[model samples]
Target: MSKPLVSVVVISYNHEAFIKQTLDSLLSQKTDFEYEVVVGEDKSTDDTLAICKSYGDKINLIFSEENVGMIPNFIRTLKAAKGKYIAVCEGDDYWIDPLKLQKQVDFLEANPNYTICWTDYSIVNDKGELTKTDFGYTKDIIDIDFNNLFTPYSTYTLTSMFRMEAFDLELYQTLKHYKDNSLYVLLLREGKGAFLNFVSSVYRVHEGGVYSLTSNYHKNYSSYLNIKEIMEAVPESRSKNMKRILNSLGNATAFGLLKQKQKGEVLTEDQLKFMTDYFKNGNLKTKLKYFKRRFLK
Candidate 1:
C-alpha cells in the first residue's frame, strides 16, 4: 500500500481468464524494491475490468469508457507511470522470475548509460503450455554495434524494461503504430541496449489475442515505413545512426515480407528497382538477408 518505486504496467482487454494470473505474478514478486501494479482495462466486454478491480488497493486499475487500441492505451497508461523505470506485462502473460524487477532495476541504476534492458522469454501456448516456436530473442550477448540493433527479427518485447524517457516527444512521433520497434530502434541509435543473459517470463502467444483482431497491429512489421520519419524526428547529430537504423528496418521488413509471402508482388517495377538498388548497396549481412527474404517471404 506504500508508494511504489517501480510501476508494473498491465494493459488488458477481455482477458478475464488469464489476467488474474498475470497480476498475481506481479504482486508475488520476491524483491525488496517497492512496486505497484497498474492495470489499464480498455473497455472489455468480458469480466476483465471487474477482475482487475477485485485486487482492490493492490493495483491501480483504470477503466476507460472508450476503447483505444494498443498504441493509444500505452500512451494513456504511461502518463500514470510513477516509477524511475517502467516494466510491461500484457494481460495474457506472466513473469516467471520473481527477481526480475530487482535485477533489471539494479542493472539500469548501476549502468546509467544504458537506456533499456530486456531479458529473454519463454513462449507459452493458449493452454499455458510452453511451445516449440522458440520465439524469444536468445542472444545471450550484450549489444555490439548498430548491426545487432537492426535485426528485424527480435522477440524482445514482453520481457524488456525501459527508462521511460526513451519515449520522448521525438520517439513518440517515430513510434507511430510500431511502438515496440520504435522504442527499441531509438534507444539503440541514441543510447545503449543491454540483452540480459537471464530468461525472465512467459510470453503467452494465444491464437485469439486481442492484438490479432486489428489490421493495424502489424504496422510494426512495416518498419520500412518508419525510416525517413525516424530520421527526421531524431536530432541532426544522430542522423548517421538513424540512417543505419532505418536501413536495418527497411531490410528487415523486406526480409519479413518475403518470409511471410510475396508482398513484393504488390510493388511496381520502379519500386522493385529501388529495393534491388538498396540490396546492391547494402552490407553483406543486409544483402544476404535480402536474398533470403526474396526467396523465403
Candidate 2:
C-alpha cells in the first residue's frame, strides 16, 4: 500500500461486542487523503481476534502472543504507526462523523503552528446510549497554550488527532503512568493545541474502563507523581511555573490520600508532610478542612 497521511491506532483487548462497531466506524471515515488503520489486539481470550481476522488485509493487524498491559500495547501500536499524523480511538469507542478525519487533517495542514487538534465528543454508556453531549470546553476554534493544557479542562481522547513528530520519545519513555495526560503535556510542549469545538466521536464508559477499576487514591497519587516528574523534565525556563502548579496538584492529591486513610489505607511519611505543609500555608478555610479531617474524626 502507499504511504498514509494519517494512521489510526486502535488499541483493543477483549472487546468482543464492540470491536466490530469500532472497526466499522474507522472504515467509514470519508477523507480525501490516505489513512491506514493499525489495530493492536492484545491476546484477548475472547472472539476479538477472530473478528479482527475477518477484516483480512483491510487493516494492519498486530496480534500479541501474550497479554501485554494497555500502556505497552499502546506504545507498540504507536511505534507501528507510519503516518505524518496519528489519530487514536480505543476499541470501545467509535467515531460519529464520517468527515472526522478529513476535518482534523484539514485543520492541521492549514495550521502548522498547532501540535494537536481535537473536537468535542459525547459520552455513551455501555449500551451505547448518549449520557452527555458537548464534552470539550471550547466554544470556537482556538489555540490552547501549554498552561491551559495543565488545567482541569476536560479533553476527549476519541476526538484527538495530533502530529506524529510532536512528541519526544526519550522523555515519553520516562513517563511510567498516566498515559493520556502525559502524552498531552509532551505534545503541547512542541507547539500549541487546537480545539475544533464540534462533536465528532463517542466515549464509552463501562465497568471495564480504567477509571472504573482503579481507586481514586491510586489515580490521584499517580497523577501527583507523574506531574512532578513531567515538570522536572521540562525546560529550566518553565520550571518555576510548573513547580507552582505541581505544589497545588500535589497538595490536593496528598489531602486526598489523607482522606482515604480513614478507610484503612496507608500513606507514606512524605505524603503526610506534604499535607501538613499545604495546610500551614493555606487560607483559613483550607486549614479548617484539614483540621476537620484530621482531628474531628
Alpha-carbon shift of residue 276 in model 1 (angstroms):
13
Model 1, position 186, has a per-residue lDDT of 64
| Candidate 1 ranges with C-alpha deviation above 4 Å | 132-141, 150-155, 169-175, 210-221, 235-297
lDDT per residue for candidate 1 within 158-275, as digits (tens), equals 7778887665744575355454656665665557878787878887767657553434314433455655555555453244555666665666655544444463346556445656
| Model 1 lDDT, full chain set | 0.71
The model with the greatest lDDT is: 2
What local lDDT does model 1 show for residue 214?
36
Give the deviation of candidate 2 from the true structure as CA RMSD: 3.2
**Which residue runs does candidate 2 get wrong by more than 4 Å?**
133-138, 150-152, 236-245, 263-292
TM-score of each: 0.74, 0.86
Task: State which candidate has the highest TM-score.
Answer: 2
